[model samples]
Target: MSELNALHDLLKGLGDEVVRSGERIVGRRNADWSGIPAVPPLAVLYPRTTREVSQALSICHAHNQPVAVQGGLSGLAGGGCTQAGDIALSLERMNTIEDIDEIAATMTVQAGVTLQTVQERAHEAGMMFPLDLGARGSCTIGGNLGSNAGGNRVIKYGMARAQVLDLEAVLADGRIVGGVRKMVKNNAGFDLRNLLIGSEGTLGVITRAVLQLQARPGSVATAWCGLADFDRVTALLRLTRNRLATGISAFEVMWPGYYEYVLANVDGLRAPLSARHGCYVLLESVGGDPARHQADFEKVLQDCLEAGIIEDAVVAASDSDAREFWNVRDAPTAFPILMPRLIAFDISFSIADMGRVSQDCVARLGARWPGSTVLVYGHLGDGNLHVIVDIVGASDETVLQVEAMVYGLVEEYAGSVSAEHGIGLKKRGVLGHTRSRADLEAMRAIKLALDPRDILNRGKIFPDELLTRRMND
Candidate 1:
């Protein structure tokens, strides 16, 4: 009751966009393609401009209130998530593509602009903003930069962070620091933009950004192939990069279990060949001419089959067919047989150790949690794999065990516990797998220096000291 009274005047003073009570529901809303339950806040405030955001943060910093900055809510990790006694700062009202610089090939867009909006705007202006994920339709540009999101073309265009030229963010002290420059080269001291990009809203609230744009793909071709095992998958990846010698936009691999689940249940999304195999990959190449790209793709697939490196192969006959093949890869419904409550883990390892590490993780998952399915697949070309530890029930106890089993093995393999998904609240305890104690303490030191009062997305990335204090009780 006292907390409400204390925040009432401050929140009410911010204008009609800010609210204290029912605003808490902002956190309860699902924000990602992952569909994890949201950890909500006590209030939510939406500000249209950096000035309004500054005013909101000023009150929050003064009150020492924990604040979670929410974008389009499309992150896999709970970076934008809020907890009790917390307030959520919303950038939804800030959605706008402010300017398009044709010569410089950059777009200054407000943080809340949906990725698709930016993409289409770039397309209409005869350019491309190549940062893409399956969730591009609803995910915000700011959220993509926050998580340093990687998607199909990551091997080529790089992650979202690399595509960002500059950004404007509101720091913890309510000071609006605008760093929106569209320069390609600047050896100007420390790069503050990179610091805020992957900090996952913990360092500051990103309000606007100048994003780099690329030349649009004039032509693209895709092929599907079934592999013998993870070893064969890696070998084929090497072959594709070496022989195909084209723009490989995507190299998505699916496990036999995952492939079968799609083939069985997802109607209209057809598998390229009827051959049953241990793994399947949907490979893509892009170039200037569709005919040359298609012929080259067919030749590559034929060579793989001749080498007996893979079991079977099929190239997409048309654009529609290509989307159908990729739909099976992108959509969750394509893999319906996967347990409803599963821990999706993405880890990176050297190509040499990937097969053994994957096998070890699967065996451990089955032994640790009997009757649960373990689906393994990845963008093998980039040494990234996705492991899903299927649980019969998603009870807290069972999920924790699955997380430990997967992450512990990841640590054993010397792989990052998180590949694309940034380490938010869920992976805080397991970060030790990827880094040493000194590394983490140094990160904490940086955090403390950036946010002295620790009001910006307080409990995310790092475990909360207050929570520790309460647990000691």
Candidate 2:
């Protein structure tokens, strides 16, 4: 019998658990939110338990069958995407909240649990799961850890990796390593849990996690302010931090083009400011005392406005109003529906270089693609900016050119190629621009040690030939 046929026979006992039909796995095995075309895997495997996952990987390891691990399929990068002859492993069945310790302020959950579920559960327990993102309803905790995701709350709660106290993962060789620690301090030895958290499933398959939780904020305040320029925006950030300190939760910024595009394109969303400006900032503060928090927020806004630091400002009068203010900044519907053919970018740079980099981006994109539009906005509080280039009828060549131009600017500004998003197939080629030669070599060494067969998320982070060429160059 052929290898494929033999593999199928060896796994036939899985029955309905093993998805063999092509039609059923159409969108199931694809990477989350990625625009890349999906390659049908040999089969999409569903393992309900860690041991089951180990069993499947053991069989695949023996047969040398490559595997791609997928969670919510909500990732922009193609790291979770499947290739030919690869078996896709979906963690959907493993969704469960294993434990929620109110006294300890921690939650132990299966990797397949959606972030939204975790958040809601934590809220019900009078705690907050601080790791939140736009894809919370769809993205899984495992994927969040795999990508080391950061969202609006990251400025306050840190990344997904920070929120995690301990985790459990299945190795490429089907060895289950469980380290579900609940203690706040364990300074005994090396942190093996961190190795798999942001490894993008290239090192091991994450199955469960023990996440640290924070006390639910009793007071939440939001404000929308229009800024004269990036300098004022930074000043506002510094002032907010200096005054409000740890109470500040979010500080989102949008350039004129991005603010205007979303304002014009997204229906039912109105601008908070009366007049257009060069920049817009949405700030949120959370604290234990509602009255004190609101007073501090208003005082800062009023002081900034009186001091000529801000052009205009509006504090959210109610929860609904705050949601509306954020809707404009989020642009959840605008970007996907209106600008369907845009190249999205998420890079981190120094706060000081933002204004120049954004101006250079707009100028360069316009010079090259005469009619193209560049939209800029992001979590400015953390220096992670999101850029979208809208070029009409852009071809493959045009995409390559635009990517190089954008990433080139990021490199010029001494920025990272990717901020929240992992280095999937999309950003694999340009990773050298951000990472050093020694760093790349060390990462490659880890990948080789963990996955000698190269069976896990192959061709996601860094390609061999490209790494060698970059090192040589």
Tell me the lDDT of candidate 1.
0.78
lDDT of each: 0.78, 0.85
Candidate 2 lDDT, tens digit per residue, 223-317?
99998999999999899989994558998999999888787888889889979887999999998888887888899899999988898999999
Please provide, for model 1 over 263-305, each residue's C-alpha lDDT reduced to its tens digit, 9 standing for 90 to 100. 6766677667777888788888877777777788788778888
Model 2 bad stretches (over 4 Å)? 1-6, 9-29, 464-473
TM-score of decoy 1: 0.91
Off by over 4 Å in 1: 1-13, 18-40, 331-338, 368-370, 393-396, 464-473
Best by lDDT: 2
Worst lDDT run of 10 residues, candidate 2, spans: 464-473
lDDT (Cα, 0-100) at 63 in candidate 2: 70
Clashing pairs in 1: 31-73
What is the RMSD, in Å, between candidate 2 and the native fold over all Cα?
A: 2.7
Give lDDT: candidate 1, residue 2.
Answer: 41
